[model samples]
Target chain A: MNPRKNGILCLLLVLMCGVLVLSGCGGGGAATPPATPPAGGSDEPAAGEPINVGLNLELTGSSAEFGLSGQNGMKLAFDKVNAEGGVLDGRMFNYIPADNKSEAGEATSATTRLVGENVVAILGPMTTAAVLGSIQLVTDNNIVLITPSGTNARLTVNEDGTLNPWIFRACFIDPFQGEVAANFAMDVLGAETAAIAYDIVGDYSGGLAASFKQTFEAAGKTVVREEQFSAGDTDFRPIIENIKTAGPDVIFVPAYYTDDGRFVLQARDAEVTVPILGGDGWGSGDMVGIAGAENMNNTFYVDFVYMDDPSLQDFVSEYQAAYNRAPDGFSVLGYESAMMLVEAVKNAGGTDPEALRSALENLGEFTGISGTMTFDPETHNPAKTAVILESVDGVKEFKQIVEPK
Target chain B: MRWTKYLIWLAAAGAFYALTLALSGAGFISRFMLMTMVQICIYIIMALGLNLITGFTGQLSIGHAGFMSIGAYAAGFLASTYGGRVSAALTEALGGAGGAAVYYIFILATLAAGAFVAAAFGVLLGLPTLRLRGDYLAIATIGFGEIVRIVLLNTKALGASSGLPVKNSVGWTTAYWLMLLSVVLIYNFVNSSHGRACISIRENEIAAETMGINTTKYKVMAFALGAGLAGLAGGIYANHMYLIHPNSFNFLKSFEILVMVVLGGLGSITGCILGAVVMTVMNNALSAFPEMRMIVISVLLVVMMIFRPNGLMGTTELRLPFRRKAAGGKEDVTHGL
Candidate 1:
């Protein structure tokens, strides 16, 4: 062997060892070991072992903001519960959070790791795509999974309307939300016709648009026009002009904040002045800045809960102080999911998977920060009211809560 | 001597298989790690295929993932439609003995179907665009990838954007063996006379053509073969993951495979394998630290490129220590022993 080549190989070997050691130390330093159960007081039963709850979230990719906010909310809720003498007769709730990187393969790997940690239940991977990717593992393991904001109708139920046994969600399904928005459009706004502009490439927007079209047309109102644009599309004048010519009473834009805000601004610029409604995808704070406050006036959207609700003032203040930002829909839903899981653990009398699952299935009207949520045994979907909020000068003001009948 | 070499290879492979099985059974290797191992194997097959096309044939393909997606969707669809029936029939025919055997056979059939469909697509894509070279060929390939993704996203029969799920799970053991076979086959092809002709074209296309070598036929053949192997990897991946989505095979995936090939030393088969293993492990390891994963990966890539611009192996192959020398007796110093 050449001495120089051997020297280079040795250098590479040392470098590789250095990297392994650094990564090992970094992982140890970052992941704080789960805390032991606290010493019990007279009223509390002897503190049992902590219950492990897994969180698979998109903490670093395109949807990192949503996952980060949810993580904060879950942390706040867990802290509050532990501080007030933890659940299941003073058993602490230990969180095992894994970042899925907002990719399908990563989601499965994250879920697999979480399951390997022996979690009693799992929460989140936020988006529908991430949930679909890993739901098989969760089901195969028979671990209870409560997603905070995966609203695709298929997540909870199969195409044939059979339940996915181990799956449950805190947010309303897309079809239900779409139906509520459509009802509000026809019955409340007295609109005779509706127009929809949605991103063709995204499942959320496309699904919502399809549902809204079905419901609105079912209500005997004409779907005047349906225009499609892909994500990252800038110009909406051509679509807005087509909608304007159709002259619908309202326009539904079921897209995320970035594209939704742009569409609103462009539609207003083109002088097509009809109320632009959307789904929860318009809940981000950046929406106001993207479409100026004035331009966003009179716009409405459906959400899990209205941020300005008087009932949630205490939670709102605590969350704002803790995170230095108001909790969005994802945050509140995350808090609700943790609260629901803890409550089920308490009701089940232990952290046994089967017991906790039964408790969740039989859970009745539990008052959450979002709303009174009750999981339907058949669909595992929470039967809760949807909130309608009107954006007034960039501020989301509470309008009405439409109940599911 | 040749028989001895073959025996040694078989023994080594068997030992590796036994070791992995023991580790997995004893719970020394976690499921996550096993999944990562399967992912590395899949990437190895993909990088090897891409290396044959881009590194040896001198045709840059930015759309290898398209063929992979085709293979995955085709295999997933077949598994969904026929997997259960085939399993039941085999079980009934062979009774208790066929329980696991049926599954292995079904997986093999699914993989073959995936490869065949993908190779057909390769021929379809290559016949038109193989005439173009360089950036034009790259652009055409990119278009092919996007077209596959968009078409799958809109096709209801293929489950649209939601993706199709294969009910029968292919364990890591089966996937590992299949991937190993693919790598061996690709290695053998790259060392054959056809491979030499492909390399000649890469060296100087006009010279090879003027020498009466059919550059067009070899180029198409190499492209189709690479694509077929990639399809086989994709089928294995789909079943191993139990899910196949259009987004999984987007341009980023192709870029990742290309990175492995380039970073491994493009023309070296052993380099592709080493590159795939290192990149996959690094990716899985860094994922533990979500905030700094991409940053660390980028910095490492930059450092690697700065140190060895031609890649880690730089066209050198790794060979068994006891392998015989070439006929000229000059000693093959290109092997990184």
Candidate 2:
């Protein structure tokens, strides 16, 4: 080889070495689809191996706490299943979790890599935007996507009045929660005028805001102002300054815990003393820590059933015993989602996703930790009541459960 | 010899295109893979352009992606609104060849707009900072890239904070072809006479000036040309996904493109392509194991810097073995096609 050729060969050699090593470490064990009957079926494994499940959660970055909590919750279920001698004929379940870092693009990237790994089923992504990016990939691959927390209403609905069978959520969609807040604002608080502020960049926040707006307007409440902010925006002073002039009875902020919590504090700091309303993104205890107790006072939001509910003392103890921490809304949803998957597997009498999906479609009157649930065929969303909670003393205390209309 | 190289090039190109087409149809090609490959192509194009400046003409650029953002948004607005209309009009205007003409027009406009916008940005950013060298130029370019991203992030007309959604009508075939054609044109251009001129500037700017090479003209030309390519990549990318989120084209993205150039060796076009592909594959494959990904890329970069800092395939083209019948002397000079 000529000297120039040697130089080029060396460069190619270096890159190829990296490529070879990276590619070699890339392959993981194949997922074994579960073999047991569906939830209502006989207790016998009817088929092959357990399924490989993929999860893309924001285990780091802005939503790290939520992601970690959800993963732990899912892990609890995985442990229980494996300990009991696995799902579907002793075929063990494999759960792989990838961190999305709370970015939609990263979440999608993670989902792609997971698909390459050939996971049979996916249980994620925590954020709605993340879910949106992953849905096409999952659906195109004919794999089932069971998002434990994604609540955007559009996920379930197509342009036509049919269901997106490939996609299912263990958690409640935004419309119900948004409506619950709307009712609380109009009927409970008797607030005639409400101003809405939410992070425009997020599909989750924006979708929930739309629901709240639609519900509030239907109830004949006058909405004074609608303001938007971007994610990673620290200063809410500008939005707050604008909101102060609007002077609504209450300001609805359907945003993530980080932004919403800080925004709440900023609103108070700016002397815009009106009560703040929010959605499920305000569920975590971390919000109080991030925004301070004084900032979060008088702020109310809708969320999943309380983790510390006395009625579910046994469940709470089991969760705490398993995870060594008190559960949050994500924990419940994660646990319930795993259980829901198990139920479908049992009902189908096999680990086959197609059969499980069929069973899921026909699923009725199933009770879980979240609440009793039913999945309508047209929209894969499960029906459940939204619980309104006030951030009293910087802690979420359940006010009332608004049953589905 | 030229024929043989062309034949080899054609075969390789065919294989690559076919492979991409097949991969695009694979059930496992998730959103991440699709987007990553798209982004990698964008970076490769941008790096190739910047290579002409910094690598080939000895002028550094840290704001390559900024020019890309401009091209992206510009072509994005056109493709989202006008691509179809123009296609319709061209079909009517050019009789049976209207669709083809519209496509050509779209490509031409996108490339032209990208070049025009990038040249403007290059001039705006370069004019003030031309006197700077090395670290200073890098800092200025990096600052300019950040400013571009921030401006895009804040601008309401550019979809505000949410960033724009890709109009969602992109065909995979069109994207793949665009990338392929770009690589070929760039490869050819880099190996041409002008390419030698650019390389001469890189080797000794003062010497080239002493030889009446008009160094400033070449430097400016290199920056403008590089900016144009970056713009073209951005435009295609914007149309490819039908989305333009400003954050996606930030300083970090600029650095990633720079990494492609640096990792590939300064003046090596072949190195850049290989590096782009390697980086793209690594990003898609290692994302599953997130912790390992950062460590892996970091170690790879470190090892490359230590062992083969010039890059993989630096200034070398891949060639097949052949014979000169009469002489019988072994000769394997790989010419970049």
Candidate 3:
């Protein structure tokens, strides 16, 4: 190409990109009025304005299964609330979801963008590491954030032992889930020794593994083996071989369904027929599908609620009807997140951020698919029961329940 | 004539900064929008750095993001641990604006230290892969980047996979100035005799060697300089985002920087700037439409590659009225864009 043509092409490239950026940024807040300034009085919105709820989720990368399910659940709750004449003086909640692309940096960017959209409160970013990335942003913005599935204990509590004030989660913290898994393995499975393999790279997995080790050892049990695997490692046969040789009565793999599913399959393939226990990371519907039900006979994991519970049957059906798919643990947590946040908004009587925050800080019992739970006033994590489910005939059957003190 | 060029650049920078402030003041640029601007500047610095190594020089270093990760972690550690004390000390000594300026200067120094470390690694990487060429060199660089990422992933003090928080007080203006400096320095470097040697190597390494250019020395120099620039960008980026993760500087990020260098034209400084801006803008713009964003971007890249295989600028520099005439005021045939 000639120099003139190249110049023209470069100019065209710049023009095209420039126009796109303008169009992208300019498509903001034209249809709805700006966030109402906090004016002490609780009054109706003049134009039926929306209570914009921002969602920063991992919708398109690793652990996307969690984010997409959580987003869908939140959408269903919003649709139901909108159908019921809305909340906070009949103002519908306009849910704005921003995909974090399953990266910590992208999570921060997504949260920053969502916070700029005049959202009343932000929810989600399903994984713990992604939640950690966005916590500082929400703290800086003085906006409330409720992650649907992120259960890292440090998210709501800082290293200095102070409450983060703005960050909360619908699910219980990792330690609690860890304790439940440990208790089930010890009491239900009658295991004296456990072998553990965890994802070293995941905040959720690492924290959960540590918590399980502590809880199990505190209960006078032995941890025979401890193996570490990074997030995307597919070779679990070596780790499984080590765990088998360690002669532990049960194996605890507190990793995500993506990694743990293959580990279970490999362990079974190696003829290590001991019971395998796991944390909430294995609570996805896709988990059993990965390990295959025949190989998952003695495999069990802690979850927020059971899908086939009589109490959650309505939510399960409603979710399936809405999305044409079964609800996972993240979906249930996300539904409860929306339900609790909307209830708080209604109680606060306005979309004022401070009022909404205080209302969320004092959220009462929210009985939904995730079982009855109320946010702890100190830590902002819900005090809820964790259920253990076993793979039974190609389905997750409720095996046991571990209630929080 | 030199003063005119310098004056024009300063004026342009001032105008751009003022426009940003004006736009933000008028509510056109939100916090997120300004954040995007900072990111764009950061990426421009990085892309320009890669352009120097792979574009101006014949060395195709694919481990640019590895250098970036090193700089980011170094800056992150410094800012989070000592940034407060250093800023306080500077402010105590200078007070107010002077103190703030000095604090920013201290941040730049930390960034420079990061660049130094990254350059040291670049030289180390270069020594081992000196004889390798083309795809073999690319594979080696890719392995180097992966090793850096994996190390960062496993380092507990650096927050492991949880990511490190950078508590530096830097912002868009810092990024803009740093990027401007990078572009100016790289532009000057590309015009020097050393740059001509590098370009000759790009054309024909054997011919360049026959012409008495120390191929080994120049190759290592190119890697060091390019890595240092990327390190500078990484420091600013970590400060801007306030968090840095190993995943942020993965192989995909390296490939993205390489794409910017290739798409902007293999040997054009001005083209790299354009490429960075376009790519970052396209990413942000398409965020408003998530479903079709990937499809659109892939289509654009494929079309651009097919239509302009030499790239958007094709070895041409952006023609400016204030730019000094090439050498003895005769019309230059090399650059006409």
Candidate 4:
């Protein structure tokens, strides 16, 4: 063959291979229309076409664990609804999951692809950075986006409290979690003074730490020391020593499990055990593995849901049986978000985005694994109870539930 | 024969533009594909700029994304704050033709502003760093990139880490034409006398200086021009994406653009365009399978490098069979470099 022809052939072969691979991976399993008629004849709404929903999550990056668990939880909820004859009187819910890979650009592209698929609603791109990256697209298209774990207060509402009509989340915002932790530290633990060690570069950590400090101080508690560290910091001994010097009754580390675990280990190794406190960022199982069982004992963090809660026992057991591990805060929130969206779709009686959005806006007091959820009309954030969990012998033991004011 | 060639080129350009307009308007192309096309256009502009500096001029700048970020933020801020009023006023004053005319004018102004500001930064960064060689210059540029990111991250007016959301000012049609214009302009520049001087500097800096090339001025000029083009890309990107974040223009992004320039073939305009399109398509295509996307892309890069070390074009231009040669012997000067 001529060299030019060979080159063209090679290019064509590669192009064909790429298209095959993309098409193979892009097919989200088709949803079959219901064949059977409703058993409850009279009041049953007519069975319609299946509803297409999109799930955008971080499946293979630093936040993969959260994304995977969220996927499992969402799938479980979806399966459960399908088994119960589906929502909208038999219109099955079909979820198309895309991996954001925990990058902002990826999040935008993934969400855009999902939008292209004509989904009625999008479930999650779990982290705050990913959520913010895709929020503009969602808002511009007027698509309903219900993130499972994005907790930045500025997400659903602007800083000045103007509502973003298209955005909502299942998990409580950072300020709420921060306030709950502060209240728990001051009232329950009887802590007079507190110190904070936060990751300055992280939106979640910085925002949570600030809210905690502000609330703690407003309640007549002294925040003795505030130390900062960016992500990828290896040494926390110096910061721990500084906190020890200030001698606060409690120390708040508003960071993810990776950093929190190292801080816990380094703090304990230094023998500076003043009851450590944090937010939902410390809910990952990696925390126990990183900080050892002994080091993790007595550490407390506020979270959206606890797997051990009696109300969530069925889900917890089912999740363990399926994934062979106990579900974490992210999983529970994911399950709740999916369930909430399903309920909204059922209530709205259609898959239209505007109808589903209004249904969500007026979602009053719905009971789930994560307490009662009622989205505030002004800000699309749900008002729900946050549970304080203490690490006892490497186990997440539910301590107390703080109800919203 | 020359007129026939020109007519063919014009017809091809017209057909391409019409296709883009039809696809975008008819909703035949998915939003995902449209977004990907916009990204490809932006990356092509950016890679072309980088190719001019690193490929043609032998200046290794690892921080081109820094200039892009500056342009993105500058344009994003302007569009967010004042674009609506200006566009609205133009639409009112111009009557029927005003809307499109205003859109073109506004987009062009923002892109030009972004390019100018980025060029200014380029001059600021290039003046001192152009004195240094290779690794030192790379480090200096990287530091400049980091400085831009840090400044944007801290500056509340630029939305800090939360990011600034610009109005969706430009569509795929506008972006497509702008990118094509940039490619043509850069192609023409690469064939100019100044371009030959830049290439000579790349071949041997000391020799070029001895040959009265004024190496420093050419180097700085190439750097500034490259940065200005990058800024133009950033402006379109911000307006198209409707949002800009400091994190979007970090080291990883710069590395990605570098990969395109290297993968396409150094000192090759056609190569840069090819590389940009292929990479952008591959990225979008493989995104669905997140687990193996990175691995697949890395393996492909490795294979391509092994097969064609100099890249797909290897400093060679792809010429049409019907085109006549240039009047002078100017083409010979570009071959050795």
Candidate 5:
């Protein structure tokens, strides 16, 4: 250890100081201007009155795509509202976005920063686990937290069925998708037995699969075979072989589109053809590219709304016109949630936390591009129409819309 | 000479604590800043623990996060199940819950509980796995970390993947003091006779063994001490975030901590501290630059490794303020007993 090299290292220390100082500017502010700069006379401009809605999305981690989509949707909603002369006496809904990095702890920290910003409500954290991790902080802060697409059944409801006041979601819970899929398979597809091959590593898939199985079995139909595969698994031969052996009337592969490609390809390769069912996570065009249109035939999944649905054309075009891309379930939900928040703020007449929460709870019926949503004030879950879109030669076609009983 | 140096270190640390307290008191520091500062302290303690084994003792225990997970769960269980009861009881003795005394007692108790549990497991793990060296040791530690993660993931009591959420009685003051205390204890141990035995083994195990040093015993001791420190860090972490997920302490986490030790210069306390602070702050700060964050971090790490293979501080410590005079070919006051 030459002491002379210490001199160079000390210079590096000074260099590190520069890094720290630069980065400090980025993360420096406590809460991005705490609660509207006091409204201190001097003719506050329109920008000064913008409502700070916190967006705690998974912008740069494993679930970056979904978070980005959600962000885009919210941004569109904000932009549209702002362009139309803003909300609540020309107050633009200014959003402060925080990337949670798709980690739970980061989500909590991000939520804290958002709360400190004194946002009337937080729009998202995209995924279920991130939402769960962030929930406590928002609850403690008494800010309404409306996730765009967090569908885990237990998110808003505890095991004992107690409801968390601050948490709400624009998307229907997992049970709705499971029930919709079960009823669709049982009543429409006329299946006596179903096979489920779910992504074991994902938080959404397992719970969704469980609910589907529960609803299917409770309706006096058996889940013939249940196979597990992790998210990154490429081979579906072993599981597909087992599913083929079981020979259930329908096969449920409840997973993200990322996992859908390999499984669908391999299952088709094995020539084990049955209607493959999934949840909203399967609503992506990548499925066609990977598994081929022929392989994706007879496949259906439950989603909030199909992009090709005539009623959704306005939203689809708006999203495409705004971002140059078609809208997915995440973006749709993000758009709906942001719009709903704007409505709530309008209904409450101000951003008073309690008033806003009550307005959100009693939002009753919200008709957005996604569909008509009637929020259950008790559970904070939405009762909305779940659409089953069938893949016909790599293109999704309208199958049927299942109304919540 | 050493006594005066340590006292100076203490004074410097005290001043730092006071300065931060004043800053936050004057509302100069944001809650987010305070949170980041606390996180740096926790990571520093963790890095120091890893530094003891992998750096000083030359044992590559990559699964340092395993001990941390164990410690966190243990602390989480205590705080969630009995935190209120204990706090209330202690509050009855020391006036009320409004005071800081009860919180200190409660947090220290949880930290100690976590440390003992992790240390006991460390002794259990090190007894058999210490025989393996280098990569083999790393592999074994990785397995241990994975196993702990899986166990926690499946445990219904801990909320599995969703994670166990608990309110914490800890704040910046508790975190800062705990870190300073850990660094001082480690410094004292490093300058002690047992520390030399461990260092001797690290330098040359065969020679140290031939010189009547109980190499295995010293190695195991270093491991337990290191693990205990990791547990302490974990306990603070759980309190800091108010949630503990097994996935957060996975294999990648172990690799990150190892990167800190190596990037900080293995076997150098100040190096580990520097590494820990830089790594943690960099992670948070990089988030501010969304798009270029990871790219910048990766490029910087590559550049650092290419130019400064020995790391920022290398084997030499940054002598703060009053420098100690080197004399008699030795820096430590302890003369082999």
Candidate 6:
């Protein structure tokens, strides 16, 4: 063999050795022995490096608006906490956001990667299904997930009616919001009969609609013409025509902004003259322009909390100054979630996820933008009040807050 | 020479099996690595089967995932419903054989069932659409995918939209090893005379027919076999993940499989393995940069296609990195034991 060729081969071998060395050294972090607590009762930043805090929020795609809102609120909360000299005595928090693509599969892959990175905790994916994926992946590695917007009833419920210990949500779920809408319908509108139209594919929409029906029936009003449609179904004329024949005083359309806006317009065009009611999903400003003011008159909905209160007036102003728009229910949920996560970390006295999880479970009197919340020991869902909103000229004007009975 | 090749292959297989055993019971990182390797092995099986038709035999199937979904749900349902009964029957038949025997038979039956069903679906899909051009075939398959998803999501008998859960780990481990072995068997099969005929059809249909190759029959057979292997992967995945949701096997999954085959180089076995491993690693690495991951992946893919479209290894198996001395001066494959 030529010496030059031999040298080249030797060089390649060295390069391969270097690569192997790097990979081995890199993976050594996983095998480190567990950290032992300090002997003394002193609480400091462990004398060396500050622990890295991970924030995995959906930062782009179909739910980009919600993700951006979550980003802003979390940034604000972190800024405020760092200003007051950080949690665990100046262990600074760092944020690392990932896009969930508004898809569960993407969320699973993202959570898996975060596990590999060995982050202490994750913040938001905004949607219930996305949160569900993160919960299973993160909890296996003892990583805490604090989500703000996922309000599905099943997030806290197992098949055998037990609570999932690893997952916790800041926002009140669908059943509470549904009952809020139900009470508002009975007390405010004095309606006798209601028609229902909901999306079949969306678990949230279906769950909320069912809760609303249960509450409405419990309140002594009959529900007529329960019809279902899928997400992105453009035609709602048949459903409207069916509802029109039933002649209900009010109709409940539990859906997101995109379909809710179109449903309102189509229902009006088909001469279905009835007041429309929805849940927090209908709190977007885009709905106002999509449905038009004329079509949205006398529409009532339930949401996290109303932003029109005097205490929340400054937040609304600040949000408008920052993003140039009135803060919606989603924005409020994001803010509350960030606040709740911070509170849990502070209460735990350290960034340890297990300690923080217990702190979250025992969380009491944490005053948030939405309402004061306390997670019931049995279920990780926050026990709080739901605020009702009435759409006047297509804008969600505050009505009243309903306390859960 | 062929015996030597077989010996080398057997040694490699033994080494890999040993590696899996060493990694499986290791700490967290090693466990994760092995799990990922198992996933890659399953994906390779699916991609290789797809390659048989789309690469060698020339048939288009955009809805390969639809057949996979069927296989997954079927496995999940069977495992949950009649698992105990089947185990008992197998135990009764093979009196003192114990749990291992039951596990072996159950997994074999599941794979066979999956292949049979997937092949049936392929034939059903192929009979009408064989005469159609490429794009039309793509559209037909896409429609089939959507239809299957809708049906699976709504069918209450198959657990409806809630999804079917898989709970057996032994079944999954068995399936993974099965897939790895099947991949090797497929590599050998594709290098055989039948595969030569299939490739001839791919190179030129009319010429292959003039050479007495039954183009239609071979194409259908290739598609059916590809679909069968995809189904097998689906069955393994269903049992391993412990949840077989209809949504898991959609058009997006088919696209990912396509990306693997394309990146691996269409006709190369080693290339397929390299592609699958690299893509999975890239996927994990880019988790931190989710917003920019797609951009990076897309750029890499485009650059690769633009430059080395033949892929890292083109139409070749992983050979000894040595050259043999020919009639010329000493080549690189020299000085063997």
* Position B337, candidate 6: lDDT: 15
TM-score to true structure, per model: 0.93, 0.78, 0.95, 0.91, 0.92, 0.84
Off by over 4 Å in 5: A1-33, A36-48, A199-203, A228-238, A289-292, B1-4, B84-104, B326-329, B333-337
lDDT at A73, model 2: 77
Chain A, candidate 5, TM-score of: 0.91
DockQ of each: 0.42, 0.28, 0.62, 0.43, 0.44, 0.26
Looking at model 4, the pairs that clash are: none
Residue-level lDDT of model 4, residues A26-144, one tens digit each, is 45322333322367764433565667788999998768988998999999999889888887657888888899877666788899988887777899988887888787888877789
Q: After superposition, how far is residue B157 of candidate 3 from its true place, in Å?
A: 1.0
In model 1, the clashing pairs are none
* Best-matching candidate per TM-score: 3
The root-mean-square deviation over C-alpha atoms between each candidate and the true structure, in angstroms, is: 3.8, 6.0, 2.4, 4.1, 3.3, 5.6
Ten residues in sequence with the least summed lDDT for candidate 6 chain B? B328-337
| Candidate 1 local lDDT, A115-221, one digit each (tens) | 76667899897988888878789888879998899999999898898888888888888888888899999988889999999997757898899889999999788
Question: Model 4 segments beyond 4 Å from truth?
Answer: A1-48, B1-8, B85-100, B324-337
Model 2 reaches what TM-score against the true structure?
Answer: 0.78
> What does fnat come to for each candidate?
0.33, 0.25, 0.53, 0.37, 0.25, 0.12
Residue-level lDDT of model 3, residues A117-222, one tens digit each, is 8887988888877888887888888889999877777788887889999988888888888888888888888999999998877577878888899999999999
Per-residue lDDT tens digits of candidate 5, residues A1-405?
A: 675566466547746764865457545454355554456643333343778898999888778988999999999999999999997678888788888888788888788767656687999998877888877788877899999888887788987899998999898888778888988999999999999999766468888898899999999999989999877788789999999999999999889887887788888899988888988888744878888889999899888777777887888888899889878888888999999999998898877788889999999988887678899999999888889999999888889988876
Could you tell me the lDDT of residue A232 within candidate 3? Answer: 78
- Judged by DockQ, which candidate is best? 3
**Candidate 1, backbone clash total:** 0
Q: Model 2, retained fraction of real contacts?
A: 0.25
Over B1-337, each residue of candidate 3 has an lDDT whose tens digit, in order, gives: 5576678778988998999989899987888888888888988989888988898776778888999999888887888888889878888988988988888777888888888888888888887796788889989999999999999989989988778987637788888888888887887777778877878878899999999999888888888889888888888878878678898899989988988877788889878888888788777666646666678778878987887887788787777643544334554333522
Superposed on the true chain A, the predicted chain A of model 2 yields a TM-score of 0.85
Which portions of model 1 miss their true places by more than 4 Å?
A1-11, A14-47, B92-100, B324-337
